[model samples]
Target chain A: MAQQPSSDGTAGLRELGEFGLIDRITASVARTENGTVALGPGDDSAVVLAPDGRVVISTDVYVEGRHFRRDWSSAEDIGHRVAAAALADVSAMGAKPTALVVGLACPADTELSWLDGLTKGLADEAITAEAQIAGGDVSRADVVFISVTALGDLAGLPAVTRSGAAPGGVVAIAGTVGNAAAGLAILSRGFRSGKAYIDAHRRPQPPYAEGPRAAEAGALAMCDVSDGLLQDLGHIAAASGVLIDIDGSAFEIEPRMAEIASALGQDPRAWVYGGGDDHALVAAYPDRSHVPEGWRVIGSVWPVPDGGEPAVTIDGEHPEISGGWGHFAG
Target chain B: MAQQPSSDGTAGLRELGEFGLIDRITASVARTENGTVALGPGDDSAVVLAPDGRVVISTDVYVEGRHFRRDWSSAEDIGHRVAAAALADVSAMGAKPTALVVGLACPADTELSWLDGLTKGLADEAITAEAQIAGGDVSRADVVFISVTALGDLAGLPAVTRSGAAPGGVVAIAGTVGNAAAGLAILSRGFRSGKAYIDAHRRPQPPYAEGPRAAEAGALAMCDVSDGLLQDLGHIAAASGVLIDIDGSAFEIEPRMAEIASALGQDPRAWVYGGGDDHALVAAYPDRSHVPEGWRVIGSVWPVPDGGEPAVTIDGEHPEISGGWGHFAG
Candidate 1:
């Protein structure tokens, strides 16, 4: 039998049960501003006043083994990754993140401290993203799983779409591009979680403000780089019905990123081209207008050649590296 | 060797990778509401406009072994459960569900048909709830897990809280209870999934409109019965700091529920008293004036005597049965 619970253990999650867990979690949580939250947690459904009558939302999931192994990453890391990914969806639309809801499932033997760590991680990221954890569900399972949903405030701004980039717009990036990939590689090769790369993998700090800033700067199209730079850019190119060309030499290199490449005995180029999860801001800017801080011109949008395939090309060629992670391909 | 890809067997999830699977899923999916979707899939995040500057959100998780089983439930059933539970959170808050975000993590070997079934089930519930699937993330894992987050609009109704009920308020319910417990018993007893009890287990069609309607009808306190009736009601009692007495005589017994209880050779009273997952509406209203249709009065709220325990009592007695489900009981 597993270890027994003592007075220290008190009433663990199993003691609370699913409904009881929800009751305790929702007990102290409440809405601050956001008039839309007419009804908060602890009901059949929460009610929010959607004044403009329209809402924007996005969701993401993080699995214990696939996304981050418990041995290599702390529970706090898992929490940050979950929250960041979900909030990035809100940022991708040139909107400000407003709230987040989380669903967590773990083995009954899981420590309550782990749950607290995860919640603390989520709360930290919410503060970073200017969002709040509104409500969520918790349950027992064989493995740990986290699901996050993020909502946003458009603030009456017109959404910049991937399909809206024109032929003449300049493609620019506004955040670190290859750090997460390097971090993943570092973690994969049995290295200890380095403070630098581990943070990249655990908490991908996306350029939240850049999304709305780019929108205000007349960005024709925009996206966040969860998939590798080339692959994600290809999506924009295909959707906009155009060609995107990246100048390999124009890429901005992070000095510390090279450390991961050296450790993995792999070229930094692979991480730059095929790595993802950096959550960088990529936008198509018209007339190469004044680039925002932390942004650099990396490529250009081109008209599709007559009857030609819409594709992303780098330095006049398609690089032969893997184009990033997929969920169902194994 | 067991079933290689060359032998007409599909590649596993790890083989296809995360990005490949995401590309495939997003490739053919259609965006129904382009205006509401500020950003579509394939980015770090997708953004949408939330004009009202307010948001309502909730989340829930459905696990394979704990929440459902492949042997007992189709992917569709699992999906329906996830949608219902998440949407019910919105309903409980007296809000209209507007959108949903799903997180799916499953084994690589899972069949495509199963995923399709789950998606169809989710869509079916969304249609019933008048909500749309906005976006989701897909990833690989050892076991199938589903996490859903739902958003809603409150239309400016004051939230009905659990602590709002006062002494002398009438206690009411909008749907049946104990059916899911009966269903779980049948499943655990090795009986195959049945059309009746299985339906109760697979899809808990809570009276979604009752929450908002109760709010409109001036419900002082409200909650969904995800725990046993007495236990869940006890939550309101404790939150409102009042004693609740259930008049067991007023329970509107259902014939089907009785049949299932008889088949299992168990007390239906236990299901009603301590079983959970019904997702029914239970509320306390002042004076019982103009109670909505389909709601049956079952009890009354009373002032706690000085130095007396504030608890739920049935017919003026504490039933021998334990209150309800707990998660971490050793």
Candidate 2:
């Protein structure tokens, strides 16, 4: 299985004891410096500030051999990307992340360094979003997995839900879409030259601030593109009772992605439309004029015909089904 | 592997699909009646009310075998017990749980009924605590595990932490202790006659309300008895800079547990002092007058002399080291 939690793998979790492991995981957190933390780890529960009177919460689970492979990804990368995945859900709701409570289930033989790297990754991502690691839990298990619960504050703004889009709305993207998928494809083929794409997959740098920015700009609907562009937009269409028509010609694959796609005998556009996990923020706006600066217009919304099911199409027709979800390769 | 997802040994999670599984899990929740849900499942994240301007949050992870054995514990019991474990953490901070976001990682072949039973257990426990299931995430793994994140409202009260105990403080407990450990012991011996003990182990009914009541009563410090009376109290002593002395004569072994221990040639007192997981609320109060009606006094707090270590003792003497931690048997 090539499972090496630590070199020599002698010092495992049981040797460290429960409290000892917990202390190491959260010891460096400066709880007092975190503005939202009224109470932090080592207590029964952490008390976090919810100044907006509401908190947006979401959970994401990452399991070894499913979401990641230790042979391909480092512990830090797994932690960072998993946090980004859950935090992006909060962003899709147009909330600013406040705190995260993480839970790790692993074999007692897990390496302390591997756990440390995971903690560092989670903390790094949370700090990037200006959130704090408030608390966490650990347990012994055969497989290694992490579960993160991300909490965010709305700051008194109305959430931009999936049902808010209208017939005349414009759809836009706020971060790199499909890059992570492209990266996963590269890795699966046993090549590692595509550093940019691979890094994107390893640690998603989601445009977190753009969520609150979109809400402020009167965006109609929003969601993070984690299930590929077409599938995710289809959800927006169904929820908003509208039809979405993406302009196929709008996307121009960058040199880095295109070069790799060419060598691999793949169409980059399919990756753009069907690949997921880049954690890009996709939203519907009134028009191009109202779209924020960081976002690029990609599609348009249309009314669903009477008794017609909501759908997402490329240039007025359904795109070909690729039937490829890269994360499932394991 | 004894993997039976359905009676026909088919219809695993991969067959039902992710959305279908999630829909069945959350379909029956009355989100509207919850009173604190600004938004519920079906969205990227759920928004819960935090009118108190603060939220108490905690996480706990439970793994198969380490936490529960399918042959020993029903899916519902596993879910219920896991939820109780996390919720007790919130109550230990003197807060009322508002919502929970759960994460499940299991084999693709997991039984739909098993998953359903687990969902029911979690929802039932959350409902009993006046909390709602806000959201959840699922992933495929070789082993089944669950992680829960509980959020609670402090209701404008200062959080009660472990560092608040003082000398001469009265140590008291609300709800039963040691029963769960006794149940585990009985089960390990292949005896199922102790229904009450077994049920206590399966579904710990922590006095959740008493936490806030204790806070209102001006209790000094508190924690759920998770690692036995002596060990958990040792934490209070270490954190509060005080030493604790249990009144050995103060505890009474209930007939249900005593009878089982007697049959097994085990001292129930060992289970009482060295067992864990009853989730009873243990607290330190200034005096008898300040102790809440539901709580019963069991020990006293004393000052730790300068440069002396904090410790927990029984009647000014170190209790016998039984070296028994029932949970570790798995």
Candidate 3:
């Protein structure tokens, strides 16, 4: 057995090794507010109580230099972002996140402190969502890769799915839109200003509680705005066999956003329509009257025309810009 | 949206894109035997029934080159190995694995056929475990990284943790040991004739059913032999506050293993004692008289001496060999 070092020196993961690091990290796991964690972070597996007799599970991966850059985001930021994104998936399905299991792969020489920060970020986010860090696995890799699997309790509500949209439904969003994409653009172009956008990109605060609210309000379909507004709406359209027509003017361009777009000489509408990683819950309702509070109608769904593709149109017209963050499409 | 090509020519992931590839792979997922999968895939999240109102969860990460080599293992082999390893963890807790959510990070230029083979392997292994492919997330990365999160149901049984071993308990193993390590050595030494050993290194078949049986028979403590016989037992010993003494002669090393070790000019005992990735289940029982069928008693547990560390000994003596597959250790 290896002993933990008494001093808090700058020892890398290689010095501590796998089990040693695991012990260090496991010791630091904060007691969570979630009472559903029957067992946490030990033994062969963790036991979690699923009060509803059902569990909603969603997983997402974040790779260094692809999903995020170490130079642009701190370890804490990465952890928070990953946790939020995973939890948002559960929320998109109209469930309350109960626990998360993280799988982290990083270089052998990674700083122990970096991992501590990352774990702190995960714990903090889990706490905000009223969930617990159930269990995780760590390994050695060339670049940092974090895979988060979030488990949620549906609380006896039917899961809102992308395939449930009806022809007369209205599409709405429960969280901010396009801010993360704008932040990414600002960071990529070497812009130092735009604190709000930059923060949105680094730490997205997905509306976690609004998901079940929307489902309870009779949301016909739901998804997270992870792959931009239009592209994700396209998913609902295709899945539900409906044509979604967006009222572009419904997305009010704030003065700050307009000013930033002017400085960058870019279109704010492009960001609003094509930006991603916002983790906003987008859902469709039978009518605007039934749309839950904090959710604003942005579009309307219609039956797909015969021999026509299920599509998303801006102001009833096809937009010139298309697609958003396809991992394999360069 | 990119359309799937009619012909299976030389199209890579880059050509087909993320959504297209996902559609291709998802279409191949087979129906699972476990009835817990309420909703499988193609949704914002997967819904699985926790019939016992409790879920056992575990996760593991497999990185290319660090955990396995493409030259040594096929996509199918990698998928099978990861799925088996993850399911084994759930089994170690005396639970029936219900579902798995996979997170894959690979290069954009990766061949489509490779991913197809990988998905096929995952589906095949899920079937073997009677679990379903619940859902997954795919992203772009420099190298292939697969994270598997397994969810299981306890079926009204208490979870078997590593801290329950009594002083008078006997340590036993329900699956083969050292075969994976021997296979790895054979592969490293470039011995192509040891097909069994090499295959074992590529794919481990754990006795999933025996875990619940051991628990029902009142096994005290249990864990999967993922980090070698001695190292993993050390975990149980430390957790249970007991010392375990192994009878080395109890491990019946087959003639094939001896022949392979002879060819490689290595001690087979080292592999048996310190080999890993076999994923065999090791348990502590009250005595050999109550040991379940298919399980062989390898040692006995005793109370730790005062002011002494809980430890493992071979034949009443400390073994010279130490350590097993520490991911960050050289």
Candidate of highest lDDT: 3
Q: Per-residue lDDT tens digits of candidate 1, residues A1-330?
A: 113333353345664456555554554343233443555665554444434344557788887777778887787777777788777767877777777777888887776666666776787787778776666777777778888877766666777678777788789988887778777888778777456876787678888888878877778878788778887788789878889999888875666677657767888888888777878878888867655666789988899889897888887786777676556654
When candidate 3 is compared with the true two-chain complex, its DockQ is 0.86
Global local distance difference test of model 3: 0.88
List the candidate 3 regions with Cα displacement exceeding 4 Å: A5-9, B31-34
Q: Which parts of model 2 have CA positions greater than 4 angstroms off?
A: A1-10, A31-33, A322-330, B1-10, B31-33, B322-330
DockQ scores of the candidates: 0.51, 0.52, 0.86
Error of 1 at B85 (Å): 1.6
| Model 1: CAPRI class | medium
Instruction: Report the C-alpha displacement of residue A73, candidate 1, in angstroms.
Output: 2.2
**Arrange candidates by DockQ, highest first: which order?**
3, 2, 1
lDDT for model 2 comes to 0.83
Q: What lDDT does candidate 1 reach at residue B307?
A: 96
Model 2: DockQ score: 0.52
Stretches of candidate 1 above 4 Å error?
Answer: A1-53, A192-195, A252-260, B1-53, B192-195, B252-260
Window of ten residues with lowest summed lDDT in model 3 chain B:
B1-10
By TM-score, is 2 or 3 better?
A: 3
* Model 3 lDDT per residue over B108-134, tens place: 778777787788888888888888898
- lDDT tens digits by residue: candidate 3, A152-208: 998899989999999988999988988988898899999989999999999999999
User: Mind sharing the TM-score for model 2?
Assistant: 0.94
